[model samples]
Target: MRIVRRVFVPTLVVVVAVIVGSGIAGGREAFGGAAVGGGLTLAFLGASPGLLDPVAKASPVASLPVALGFFTVKAVAAVAVLMLLLGDDGRGPQLSSRAVAAAMIITALTWVTLHFRALRRVRTPIYDLG
Candidate 1:
């Protein structure tokens, strides 16, 4: 139960936010397709061995740009999810306006919780000295 509350629920919230947001912002076709594609790409990249060998071999200076690029893509995906949720309702699920509004509100609250948790962690530092 504790794990469900602390981990599963939060994860679910983020996922719902991403999916609904993407669907709404990009319309059904573009946003949904992008979401699917992005998930597959991430999975493939993560599963593939030696995919990061070149980056690992690169100097820190050379790898910095790659790291930045990776983060940028993630940020873009996050924005895309939000934008998609708030954008036109293309040939996707015809959720009522009220439902969409509710979903937006829920997503916002979820994000707030996530941010709050991160802030709490930052503010209350814990040190582990082995």
Candidate 2:
């Protein structure tokens, strides 16, 4: 349990970092597209309990449904991006490049917070174990 809790948040941070880096290099459209796709994938995996079992069982048809689900979600997210970009005027608080950068920084800080929490949880003795 400790291992799972320790690794899960850091893994999420790593994934967010990868997505942000890819977006920075590939431009806004590419980054947005990738974010939509990756977010759907992650959300699907997190929500669906049996989705991965078929893949592990090597059952292609069973895997098809999960794949379709993720694809549908990604498509919806992409459409959402299109709607936001096309419909919104330059008025409200927009998500600029700077916002994306700040979000990435916040994600890193989240990882640091998790690390500190884990460190605090570790038991320390007056005498050294070694």
Candidate 3:
């Protein structure tokens, strides 16, 4: 929970900043694209720990496979989003794909960086006598 909070706060700040910047640069379409990208990424990142932690605690051995499956799902979903935003077929509503991509990259970097920092600060005992 502590790590989640640590990562979520800064990531959200980055998301909002990117969305605002997109809006200023490319107007409503861009803003909407950025919002969608940021929101999806945030949902994926935010749900990871909350959803997986219980599985991990229940069966550490099973956690790895479950995590891998979860990641695969996220990856596929991201690709689907990129396809939708690309809108290269001339059949869907247009959006600034660049804005969406940018927001996703920036927010993802923030998430990874904050997670690393939080993990580094963790103090775990190597041995428990009790």
lDDT (C-alpha, whole model) for all candidates: 0.48, 0.53, 0.84
**Per-residue accuracy of model 1 over 4-123 as CA lDDT, tens digit each:** 245335645454556666677756554454454344333323322232346757665666677667657756764565456534653234333343344444444554565457556554
Give me the overall lDDT of model 1. Answer: 0.48
Better of 2 and 3 by lDDT: 3
Error of 2 at 22 (Å): 1.3
What is the per-residue lDDT of model 3 for residues 1-130, given as tens digits with 9 covering 90 to 100?
7899999998999899999999999998889878977988888788889868999999999999999999899889877876776665622375667677788888888899999999999997889899
| Candidate number with greatest lDDT | 3
What C-alpha lDDT, on a 0 to 100 scale, does residue 85 get in candidate 2?
46
lDDT minimum window of 10 residues, candidate 1: 42-51
Q: What is the lDDT, from 0 to 100, of the residue 124 in candidate 2?
A: 60
- Best-to-worst ranking by TM-score: 3, 2, 1
Collision count of model 1: 6
Measured by TM-score, how close is model 1 to the native structure?
0.30
lDDT of 1 at 20: 66
Off by over 4 Å in 2: 1-7, 49-130
Top candidate on TM-score is 3
Off-target runs (Cα >4 Å) in candidate 3 are: 88-92
